[model samples]
Target chain A: MYRLKATFIKEFKLLSVDKTGITILFIMPVFLVFIMTLIQQQAYKSMSQSGVPVLLVNRDRDSLGTAVERGFSNFPVAQLTVDHGERYPNEDAIRKEITNGKYTVALYIPANATKILEQNVEEIMGRMFNKGQIANNTKVDIGIIIDPTANKPMVIAITSRLKQYLADVKTGVLFNIMGSKIAGMMHAEIKGGMPQEDIFSYKENYAFRDNRSSYQPDAVQHNIPAWAIFSIFFIVLPLGGGIINERSEGLFIRMRTLPGSYLSLLSGKLLAYFFIALIQFLLVILLGVYVLPLVGLPVLHIGSNIVPLVLLTVVLALAAVGYGLFIGTLFDTPQQSAVFGGISVLIMSALGGIWVPMNIMPEVMQKISSCSPLNWALRGYYELFIKGGGWPAIQTEVIKLSVFFIVCLAISYRIFQHKTNTN
Target chain B: MEGKACIKVRELSKQYKGSSYLAVNKLSFEIYEGEIFGLLGPNGAGKSTFLSMLSGLIKPTSGEAEIFDHKLTTDTELLKRIIGVVPQDIALYPTLSGRDNLLFIGRMYGLSEKELKDTVDKYLNRFGFEKNGSNAVKTYSGGMKRRINLIGGMLHNPKILLLDEPTVGMDVQARTSTMEFLNEVNEQTKMTIIYTSHDMEQANTFCDRVGIIDRGQILKLGTPDGLPASEGCKDLETLFLKLTGRKIRD
Candidate 1:
């Protein structure tokens, strides 16, 4: 343990003197989180207010087409721009407009839309009033054109809202057609002898409930943990580079003469780097909770599960330090280690959904992301910040990160032993 | 006059994995207590390799070596505690101050905090760098770094000291000061020193006995004046050239 302390002190002192390394380890993460959160916040607000640029082509001159136009116009989240003409534009022209960036999305309501909806309503009334015999001969197909160049999230959001609006319109038409028939039946029953008080007491209420405390999307909740995990993984550059430099400079050979095992030396480095990782994690959290709020960004909350949050951060640091040691031991020169470490961290972070949320990614990519250690840490953070989950929610991810730490440390120790023995 | 053998090598040999040539082959020698022995050779002649094996940095392929009766292979931890190794290259952290570097190494050697502090301060004062000891090693001159490197090894005050080209790249003044300090430490402390060097003049003047080595084997071993007389040469350099040949090794 004393040997480990010495090693830790030595590594800590060495790293502390390196101004650039210190800045990257602490300052860079805070800066990235602050800037990214502010930028994403602005984007969310703009996206909500500006609304998706939608071009509506109405071919039906009846109430259904007008209803469709009015539905988009009344929707608070979409900008409804109607093209008034006798004929609807061709599919090719709509596609061209989308490609030209004139609009992000386009909706075409066909001439038979009103007729089809009316027929559906009539069939529904026949089923309810007559003995369940009805004819439905019309199919309602609304063509939606989306700009391929637009971001995936924008395209998905607009398409979802359009589908929801159309469904609501269909439901309203069905209700309108069924109301009068049900009223006539009620009137006949009342004359025979029914209570008017019961009819007036009929009430149905609708509300929204979430699994978590609340369902609000805020940038700080996402960016703080994501960038913090990214910064932790980046410990590879300085830690790995330092290891390579020590080997090349003959410090390892000199160190071998000391009365301690190689494990002690490695343990010392692990202890030091882990402390650094923890500090980085806390700084990012502090920035989100206190500093960013002052700048008008939403405050980040760690929910009620402090245990899992702390456990996950420590395990993540260990995993990152182990990875740094492996890279340091594998490479022969500082430059080699630097390039490999830098590029590998960036690639892993990107794959792990640090740059974009995993929910927005394709299914195949989401599956592949599970292999990244960064993904494990990010998932645990999301459970704490977004899901407001306690220990039961984040236990699996914490165990996985711990396993990653052990595996990486084992491999690194073996390589270090081989190199020192051969040296 | 020689004392008891501090180090003994019995046909020690090392052939690196996947390499055809032996770096050190069937070499046998002994250095007595309180003696300064020098291993002289050209580059790649296995001088550093032999020193590394003695320092317990690498394992020999065959035979065995014992330092102070501790086997180099089996009793490595014990041997490490008794031997001080100053490598060929500057091994101290460039970012750490000289004092911190010394104290850190001393702790690794199992010295108590108070002991380490006193030892570091004593060495710094003796080396005439007491005032500048707080400065980082990267800011130090070549001579200052060399002094700190030497001090780092001796902090534990081991019985056997192994130095590999300790004064290779220093200026004349630095080299002279380093040699003077080494001689003083040898005479005052009676520590057994095994040094390797390509500098014939330094070895000739500084070493009590010198061995000429080439091609993984020792060609000649004796007092400096005695080895040259046997080769019919006036100096150690001429004797080395005569035995190792004139070809330059890469």
Candidate 2:
């Protein structure tokens, strides 16, 4: 116990003097969390939240054009711009606007669209009644010009939405023509031409498996946990480097002659590094909960209960410290451990969804992601923040992280023993 | 001063993995209690390998050795309490205070908190480090750093201390002071000291007896003053070069 305490004190003193190590352990993580969250928030706004801009040149000057113009105006999926009673721009101007990326889409409606639709419907009905050929003979093509530089997926989605809206507009115009013709033939009075109220509507909901209104994931929700897990795993840099420093400096030579197991010395150092890991974790969480909101990003929602999160953080710290001990024991030189530990953590972070979210990764990568210890830790955080889960939801991650800690520690001890024996 | 034999070795050998031959082969020697014994050798001469075997840092392939009835192989953990090793490198933590370094090492040797504090205080003054004990070791000079390194091993006060090139890199004054301090400690505690050095003259003057080894076997062993005359050399250095050869190992 004394040895452990001594080791802790020694590490604390050494770390206190190491400005670079302290910065990496504490300040860099907080800074990274803030920077990454802000960057991803902008990406989220551009990709998902903000509507695509669409410029409309409606030429019909009647109900069909007005309806089409109104359909896109202030739409959640698109922002529509249409000038009333203004000179219509030519195809060249519309193409130029789209080409310059002034708008993602430029739509044109032909002149007399309502009249053409009404004529087509009446002629088709009359032709059928007279036992003649029936067809949409009169042409009224709705033109769509798209920006070449626009994202293909976003353009495809917006275009698909535009097509559905146009089809509905055409159906409404045809229905109005048919209704008025029927009313005139029966000599009946029908107030209001083809009721403007929608016959059908769709409302999409964000739901849990139980269909509860689940919280939406923003950049803060995703990045905070990811960067937190990344920072925790980064403990290996200082921890492993410390061991290598001791060995290279000949401290290990003196230590080997001490009358106790190396674990006694290591436990204190592990606890010290674990303390640093906890601070790093808390800094990230605090930045997520407090600083991110101040920066105008969405507030990080850590669910209602923090008990499971706290438990998981402890276990995650252990896993990180264990991994650090293993790396430290395996390498003989500081430079070797630093390079390997730094690069390996980065790779783990990449695989663990720290750099990219798991849901966005390819199917094969998602499966491989589960193999990273950082992923296990991040999953626990996801349960707390995104899933709004308790202990049971994160039980698997907790178990996996715990087992990883044990395995790393066992390997570290065996390696340390082997080294001491070889010495 | 002569005393009863406290360290005994017979047919001790260590053949490291992948090595062609034994690093310490069929060695036999005994070190008496309270004697400053110097083990000398050039590079790759098995001095370190032999020291490692005696200190229980590494296992000997074939060996039977005893220190106060503690077997080298079987009672290694028990022997650790009785043995101390000071490496050639400056092992003290540079960022930590010299006092903190000693106290931590003392604690690792299972010294209680009060014992650690008291022993560290006493040793800092003994090594003339009290004035600079609170300062970080990195702030200390090379000699000061060397002093703290030496103090780290002595904090536990083991019965037998194995020093590998303890005074190799110090200036003349620092080296003289360090040797004088060790002599004072040896006279005061009657602790058996087994050290290695390239400084043949210092070893001749300080050590009661000396052994020059090469290729894992003892080439010569006798009292320091008696060794040179036995080899018809003017001094220990001349005799050492003659036995170990003039060719540079590096």
- The lDDT per prediction is 0.84, 0.84
**What is candidate 1's CA lDDT for residue B181?**
84
For candidate 1, the chain B TM-score comes to: 0.97
What DockQ, between 0 and 1, does each candidate earn? Answer: 0.69, 0.72
Q: Give the least accurate 10-residue stretch of model 1 chain A, judged by summed lDDT.
A: A189-198
How far in Å is the alpha carbon of A34 misplaced in model 2?
Answer: 1.7
Weakest 10 consecutive residues of candidate 2 chain A by summed lDDT? A206-215
Please give the lDDT score for candidate 2.
0.84
Tens digits of per-residue lDDT for model 2, A61-105: 787787777767646667677844264557787887787778898
Q: If scored against the real structure, what TM-score would every candidate get? A: 0.85, 0.90
10 residues in a row with least lDDT, candidate 1 chain B: B1-10
